[model samples]
Target: MNSLSAANTHFTFDLFQQFKTSKKDDNIFCSPLSISSALAMTYLGAKENTAFEMEMVGALHFNEVTENTEGRTTRDHVEKLGNVHHQFQKLLTELKKPTDANELNIANKLYGEKNYQFLQTSFLYYVESVDFKNAPEESRKKINSWVESQTHEKIKDLLPKNSLEFTTVLVLVNAIYFKGQWDNKFDKRNTVEKEFWLNKDTSKPVQMMKQVNVFKFTSLEDIKAKILEIPYKGKDLSMVLLLPDDVDGLQKLEDQLTAEKLREWTSSQNMHDNYVDLYLPRFKVEETYDLKDTLRALGMVDVFNPQRANLSGMTGTKDLLVSKVIHKSFVEVTEEGTEAASSTAVVVNVGSPPTHPFHCDHPFLFFIRHNKTNSILFLGRVSSP
Candidate 1:
């Protein structure tokens, strides 16, 4: 779980950098967990170089203890990879365990061409085989339906029209839905329109929710930032908010950000209970991304290239390669709490807080994480609202 959390932090930052380059002025939101889970399923079918590339870029840690074999055999490596998937399965099970305090769901599925040769024995624990040959559109609808169901209908049309074709071989997907009420709920009656500083001169009106409460908070004088943890109802999950002292200091914070830095900032020792006067805006963010280029930038090249790709673990032949990776995420933060959903499809076509006067009146970075596992469920930057 530590390694998985670290991997998620690393991937979140990497993906943020990619998105920042293009949509610098827009709010950024994503589910690194969803993306990693979907890819981990795909990684099960990767072999040799393909496997290595994914393990490196995806931050999947594997412990290889070979007793007597010369180095490691293909069978041995595959078995080790299976162990990793099993761990992920366990983690997912824990995440989805029934809880009345919070409504959370995480699901994964796989769709393959009916005629395609897929190894039933090698399939990951969460994969569900679906036929995509006779009617590609119908298969698309079915996959989208599953995503919609998993996300409680917050996510729809995950695989857009004409996205799936007859030539498509495999598709892997992950969907996550979370609805958690704040331990210290803000009063809707107290919410009012307030100024949100986008920059030094630019500002916009936002529906700011006000609250005064004791929360886990910290001040990072070194980075000129303040951090706060807003726990959900179950206390097993939290939204950690990082706000810079200066209105336009987000870029500086980003410049100094890293997985270790995040871990250090979010460490329990650095946080303590403090009374806070919080002003957070009610906002919603919906984002979609095509991650082929981003994955390539992160050195996951072979999986997207048919010529050099090696996903023989799935078909026992080198005829399968990922066609595209599409991700869609939605989040709604209000006075009561938060409702967020996200879906990630590896279309292998083949292939908050804080008060402390911790008023988040300006742009800030935030992450939703499971407290026990430290696994990041979602990450985003609230630049506008």
Candidate 2:
């Protein structure tokens, strides 16, 4: 497969710029890997921008994961991710975008006939010319098991619930395992039962993490926002918090969010010396979503348009179409810090932040990012401190 090249660098950057600008906050991060994936998929006849944008929006579902998942294992999370990807792909395939007569017919046939049905199952399938039918049954089963285990079995069956004859095929499988502890470990003694501010005049009883420390943070008047950087145990990951000055000023921060502005704000974060008392709730969130509709809304109309897509690289016949896209994420928050895992993919990756003594004490938007690439792996908001 061809790699993402410099030829489309500006176009790709522009796409991301538009994506960041459209968001109410700088919540989207794309990794080079994601970019390459989309580019290669597109080169094979997939809609590149649609795939990339869908991945970005797919990240949003993780917010719910951070709240629902308590002690789920990494294996469980991986399967969940696969199922989510399948659904998202389904949505992409079904979207009604502008297309020519032939591509349109192909789109309907590809999705209508359930050619991509393998997506909903556990056996991850790609439309490259290769045969695994004769490759040891044990090998095929192992590949399926690994994909299931890594995605936490969120994806159950892979090779379709039914048998259908397919010609060309390609498959790549990998898994990610993550486990981490809270930074300020909530003191069982200090974990007093208190009311959390859910909205003005509305509160709910919750066990919040309490701490006193110097937190690396910044207050941006220009955007009426505050930023706090919370480091993970390994220091390989950190959460960047964005808090609106006004309790309900999330809109203001959203309006100012942009790729350039986010880059500037993060780059300019300064270490500080000050005492801060923090009270944060302990919560676990988990979420799963089918990303077909979201991708359609992001201007990726062609990939799903079977009649228009030219994935001749994957299938000599213009009969293959992306059928679904699904994503799932998990996160747990407590006094010590947060542990989060997102499965699915994006084109931007956030590199690790510079380590400085900091504590999360208030409401903020935090993003998990890879340190080297400065790409955002995940982005979330804690509404209460």
lDDT of 2 by residue, 6-64 (tens): 21222334434444455433334322223323333333232234333333343222112
Residue 275 lDDT, candidate 1, scale 0-100: 74
Among all candidates shown, the one with the greatest lDDT: 1
The CA lDDT at 161 in model 1 is: 96
Looking at model 2, report the run of 10 residues with the lowest lDDT sum.
101-110
lDDT of 1 by residue, 269-302 (tens): 8899987877788989887777889888777889
TM-score per prediction, in order, is 0.88, 0.56
RMSD of each candidate relative to the true structure: 8.5, 15.5
lDDT agreement with native, every candidate: 0.78, 0.42
Name model 1 segments beyond 4 Å from true. 57-76, 122-134, 340-355
Q: TM-score of model 2 relative to the true fold?
A: 0.56
> Given candidate 1, what's the lDDT at residue 57?
46
Residue 376, candidate 1: alpha-carbon lDDT: 87
Question: Candidate 2, 23: how far from true, in Å?
Answer: 12
